[model samples]
Target chain A: MIKDSTIKRSKVTLSNKYKNIYEKRFSSPLKRRLAVLKASSSIVSLGKYVILFGLSFIILYPIIQQLAVALRAPEDINNPLVLWIPEKFSFKNFEISMIILDYWNAFKNTFKMSFIVMFLQLFSTSLAGYMLARLRFKGSGIIFALVMFTIIVPQTTIELPLKLSLTNFLNTGVNLLGKSTTLYLFAGLGMGLKSGIFIYLFRQFFRGVPEELEEAAYVDGASPIQVFYKIMLPNAKGVMITVAILAFVWQWNDSYFTSVFVTDANVTLQTLTTKMMGISGNIQSAISQAGVWQLFDQDVTKNPLFTSMILNTSGVIAMLPLLLMYVLLQKKLFTEGIERSGIVG
Target chain B: MISKLKNNISKNTKIKYANDDELLKIERNIKSKLAKYHEKCEKLSAKYIILAKRKQETNKGNVKRIINVSRQIQRINTKIQRLVANLNIVHEKKFIKRSIVYKIKKKFSEIPYNKQKIVWGIIFITPWALGFLLFFLPPILKSFWWSFNDVVPSGTKILVNFVGLKNYIELFTQYVIDNNNIFNVQILLFVQNLAIDLPIILIFSLFIAVLLNTKFKGHQIVKAIFFIPVIYNISIISSTMSKGFGLYLENNTTANILLTTQLTTFLMEIGIGGSFIDIVIGSVERIFMIVNYSGIQILLFIAALQSIPNQLYEAAKVEGATKYETFWKITIPMVTPILLTAAIYTIIDSFARAPIYRFLEYAVTESRYGLASSIAMSYFGINLIIILVVLGSLKGLVFYYDKR
Candidate 1:
């Protein structure tokens, strides 16, 4: 009976100790600490939104600035009060941008080259990828390694040699460097505009397919060629769309390759933008040559601002189509294609 | 023991029906007959499968999905065929062991499968190989050769003089007319830029990706805003930023208004001094410069983060780990391999896509091809060294899970 009483007493003491600890936890000091933790975490989350929005503003700054400037009259551009909203709204900048960019003609030329190369790269890269993924032949491993090397190596390493040698590659006494067909020729060979990445994507996607169908076709008296055509190619719609859009977008933005191959007379939209980047320096000379020197701004110091204005408009014009394309196809490319294509590594 | 006993009983039944030699003959006949029958069935089923697949393809080009389903169906079909064949197994016919084709195959064993495979492989990659020869090879060789020699342009043809690394010699030894150390300064500045930008971009993207990966509203719109810069051309971005920044700074009153009341200056007034202020302002400026640059890295990090199993986090939480500890210990180790990929991609993208490369190309257009090639080769070499160094260091830390 004494032992049982002691046990009950100890149990009661233990309960009292637990109550004391619980009360201490709910006391002002500890409660303040808990509240601080809660507040800090909420602040962290709020900070994330604040930071994200600020960065977003920085990214949108140029586009927004350009929009404001493009809509402003020339006189209002110099007005100190005119910043975000123009005093007088006008479409003069758009008209000037169109003429400077030679918008329609340059668009036609760029569209032609970009379209042809995009298709060429689509076919050549797909073929290259198919051979590497499906065909098991000796030295296939080595060939694939070379294809990977092509992707890794910078284009600058080869651009000079390519330019130098292509002029005389034909040995037909005609320099092939400046011809429009050269872009197609290069692209058709699987050496153009991120084709290596496309080839890699195709190879990865093809590798994901089970070997059973191809084997069955082979056993059913289908040649390797027939198997690829009838079985493999039809099953590659996702990658086809993915690669096609990628090729088109990349080729459209390509100023480096086109600059090397095409000359001044064949200026595409990208080349035209680059050409106009420094047109402020030549603006005076151009004005003088046109015999209308007095109509333009003769002050050289203010030419840079004029140049910036032109560039802002041209940049907007050049960027608009791609932005539209992205808006249209971003659902497919950004979320679906990126995930399935194994582009993240 | 039970299995052995069962096996012996089956053998005894077969032997009871016939003498031991005839039983052995029957067993051999059954084995060969079953093999031949299965082979024929396999070929027939393969034909059926091909027909079914072709029909399915015509019905709908389902791509990757249909193949998996059809493969499953084929598996079931084969199993049923095997079970039916076992019920009515037949005797074997005489096998052709010494056909003329076999004899010829033996004679040509030296050429063998390897040779035929080589031929087919060559056929498969013929277009790329041919193109590489026609277009890629000559230029690559010429670039290397041109770096050592002098290229002089004539009316119709060019003169190539073998100067034995004279171009490289002049590049390194000859001082520019200006007192400034031009090449090294540019190289150092580029390296500094990379060193500054690469880590900041990587860490910033990783941070943003973590935030975005959380269950938040409007993440998609924010992500689209961040990625819009990627869709915009790099040249355009650089040009716009440079020219726009120039214009912004040209307005003295506005510049003073923006800079004096900036976040960095406010932080400075609050006792954040020394290099912290510089770093803060520098990062802000770089964030503006390379805001779009982090899009792909963010996407990649998000992918890697999502790929990490949730159970790991649950386990870590149960173990009383803090969020910071969980990130460092669990998230980082899991995403290290992906980090390496992003690093390599960033290195390549930064190296090749720099706006400064336009100046290098400008040199080539102005008939300074030899000097331009030398400069390019030098920078390319430096880029290679940098890549190798990054790979060597990071590869050690990367936790590559053996996917097999």
Candidate 2:
């Protein structure tokens, strides 16, 4: 959905340096207009690249703001405008944010979920798509049609069935007002089930793969799994990455699942987004909610622990890794690629 | 087997019947009539036989005539027997009526498992399933169901009681606890969204998209800047918005911000100070912004332009057509599809996450999830209707290149 204007900038990157030379040869008004047309067309090619470059800064602003906040001393959290680099820098807020979030465990949990979902999605979607695309089975057409239809079913439609199924299986009591384990059951790989949508994308990519390649391999005496791994999967590296990157970012920002599943002190970054509005902050509301008005109001900037909780936990720590990673290597992260494989459906 | 079926079909004609009773009724009536006719014929035949014997004794000519009449009577008897058998076979078994009902039931049963129906179910149902059930279902429904009949604030009753759609009806007609209008909040939201955000998103996205489609230097760089806001974390952006930082320049006024002459911003504030100076400044700013962002529209124009084929323009030029003449004749009709698609998408995104919904969401925290759900469902319905109508109007007008 990047606006098509971003694509147009490619036209400009083409050289306009030879204009005078061309002008001499094509001096007539008709020829001049045609020359201008070619130049203009070349300039238009720069559109997409320019759109991307411009979009980068706008996209990074929030993260950049977060970085600025994190770098500030705990005392400065309340200040709405931090105009420049702080007089005194402190890494203490990072420490507080990390401990509050249980960074290592949360990180581990996130990684575990992302990887598991990716594997489940790729395996399920590919195998299913391959069969739909290739194998001459009676219900193959029905199955392909089934997957395509599944693609459009908004995630909300299956929420009740999914929640009920998860709760019954896990036997974990539901959190009526907050996130529960039920949200993550089949959303991410939970050392158990994986997301259904991931399977759909993978299967689509697999379906586009030609049948003759697999058949030729079969004639040479390879098993189905071997054909997939060596012959097919290896060839579809680009689409696999596209799907993988999509899965990673999607699960990384798994706000809905986390919001529904885990409503506790152990809120992940994604779930924290859902919880934000609930933690309203007017000075009066804060003091009333804190259960210590005078103390909090008078010296939030003074107290170490309170400052840490507010500044480190809310402002800085939540976005630390994402901010760092995006700033450092977002290009690589989103670029997950081996080139546009003929494999992409 | 085919020959036997044909023979049987030829033998029995009265097969189209719903039940045994109707077939039997017709057969019984036919059988009685045939019997009456047969008895009459038999009586005639006996008379004829007796006459023939008398005639044989008296006159040889009379005997021959009586025998001929007797033979005719025998043929009639055989035909009546065949008719009776045919009637018996027609009413013998259930065929037509039972089969009709059976076929109807079979068709209805097949509907649930039909592949196309299942696909439609998945596509239409998934988004709502996730929204309603997983995201808001258990909580909203429980609350809606519980809103009626006091929860016996007495805690002594450890059981949650079933109240009905009363929570729903009461929302609009009365309050859950007191008399308040659920329709008020829903109506306010409906009005604000339709009036403001939908139009803003549609106008801005198209304008920006068009501008980005240009042949300007560093145009791609500029496009990336605008789009970046979309992919930025909602939480981060919202937080930034709440903090009173991202939206404003150093000053709250548009004049100070547009001092840099960012063409789009400057033109947008044309009437800001409400004078001729401001208007002139605004128009120039608009032009600059257009030229700057023309890269995007230029790009789309290029695509739409490229899609038109140069042969068209060359032919037009050859025929001495002006640029304006060529443009109206070519560009507008060709790009209508893309424009429509963009409009629909922009509308969905703009209103789906509007500030009104954000504000109303807080009311949801106070156990107003049902009202929230109703509002959401209603909004989604309206969006669907608008999209369908706009596109539906253009459906016939669409010149599908592939179809052609």
Candidate 3:
């Protein structure tokens, strides 16, 4: 309002436009903008809210659909009304999907796989990122550049190479050196869940942190290694959590590389998603309340339902990490930070 | 792991960590070549810039025709600038600022050997060198040899013989590519997907991204609904969809469009007077594919949208620009980088998560290993071609190696 009035008044006093107070309005745009923003803060914007909510339902709908199907008897999964809420809820299929799939074992394997990878990832990425960021030692910059360049290479292109080593290298463990070995040593690191990308992101983020924090520690008689552990690492909690969640979810849902890698060793666990359907053969009857009666009536492969039931249990087991991730990092899961960190991958 | 890292660390250190004297000579050789290139570029760019300005004034097809010529000029100018900077680096034996912009032009020759070592490594080193050797280099190298050579499958192990690139040769020439250079079923699935899938997703994603990123009604709700699909496994959804939801949609026009291009022709071929039959089937199949992969494009678009600073639009507004003008001028140019990003992701994605991959996976586990590898290799080749083509220079989008 003041600027508008001043502009009109300046035109009237045409010759000496700067005679009246004029330096205050236009200098420092940020201050002006901030003031304007404060005045209009009550407008209550809602753009991102609607989008996240709507997209969440779409993301949630499939899992919700699967859950509803698992909850009802097998036959009712197809019934249209099951989309809303099942007419009659029975715990048979959930019980079976849990029991027959050896879900406990699958959960153990999946979590074991997730935590092992997560620990390696967090440790390696933090150390590497710290080394690149704070330590200005020789060859450090070269290592940093090498990490950045890996960001663009198509991962699937690497799939064949990764797959070949897992099945051949570990299985036989021999090369031109004739180093014959065993124990699937590679349980092997990758194909899908990329820790390499995490290192790049962590490094970039850590680089942004003020060098004074690390420097101050060094001046106070702390060693380089201590600076990394006590100062730099503790400060890097946000990225660590984000990356840990991302790695776990990515590994859990993975369909491709894990299939190639763990095929021989953990055949029971690696194909957990596919094996859920495998154990509970013809889930068509696992759908409705009436379907439960039909399941027991049928002369299917009925062995001891204990060990066999564990197979169907893996499906429910698989959903745990994602659920845990959502529950934990719900705020960071759907925000701008993902775009920044996720781009490194 | 430390031992492995040590082992995987490049064995070619003889080339990388060469003696200082030898390294200095290699650096000199590179700089001089760069200088000559730059000198040529400066002259060419001036001439092209003049021509382009004239063409623009005239407003003709000459503008597009002169694009390559002008680009060459730009490249040369950039080269000349680099060459001039190299000369300045020699004068300042002890550097305050290593930035090329801060350097003056006559010192190219005298920069010390140790300083040169760091710069050479910075520009030429490959970060993925470790990953490539560990993940990609070995097995793919073996696969390159294996795929070509015949490995007669035995019970558990296979007998191998070198077939002299026969597998690689047959991938394009024999089994897949028709006599006309068009790919067959295996190669066609790989090639045609990107052809159809990329443009459709790119367009739709941009549209949705613009909407989702906007300040509108229920934006969070919309975004959440869309992103929900990302977490749910595609194979599971696709499997479940195909069983019921997809089956129901199979009788639609869209599915029919995918199945048979011409409905009347399909009906006539099937001895029907008129055809709703084919139309229904094609439409449903298309819908099924959309449901399976819809999550990916949305994610890519979201990433692209988030990168674009809101201030660009605000600046446009301050300049008395309309919303439409702001979109065309600021938004399009800002997001063109992401178009390249999306193109790469979509190509990679179609090969990885698409229905065709599922089909190939099914074939592989069923012990049709020959056919499965053939399909896998064929897809790999097609995807490789696109990546090579798009990334002709490894400089599609200048990622913000942002300091802060």
- Candidate achieving the largest DockQ: 1
Instruction: Note the DockQ of each predicted structure.
Output: 0.30, 0.06, 0.11
Q: What is the TM-score of chain B alone in each candidate?
A: 0.62, 0.42, 0.51
Poorest lDDT segment (10 consecutive residues) of candidate 3 chain B: B90-99
Give a tens-digit lDDT track for model 3, residues A1-345.
Answer: 999999987676644456332445435787566656655543424434543454455456556645544454444433444443567776765565554445667667666666665665565555555556555458676666555434444344344445545455546764411111111222122222554556655765676566688668756866555666688667666567667766666666765545545553235453455445443455533333223333553333232322222222334455655666565655565563445433321
Summarize candidate 1's per-residue lDDT along B142-162 as a digit string, tens digits: 777778878877876777888
Local lDDT at B359 for model 1: 48
Per-chain TM-score (chain B), model 3: 0.51
Better of 1 and 2 by DockQ: 1
Q: Candidate 1: which stretches are off by over 4 Å?
A: A1-41, A130-138, A170-174, A201-242, A264-307, B1-124, B175-181, B244-280, B303-326, B353-369
Q: What is the lDDT of residue B19 in candidate 2?
A: 72
Model 1 misses residue A338 by how many Å? 2.2
lDDT winner: 1
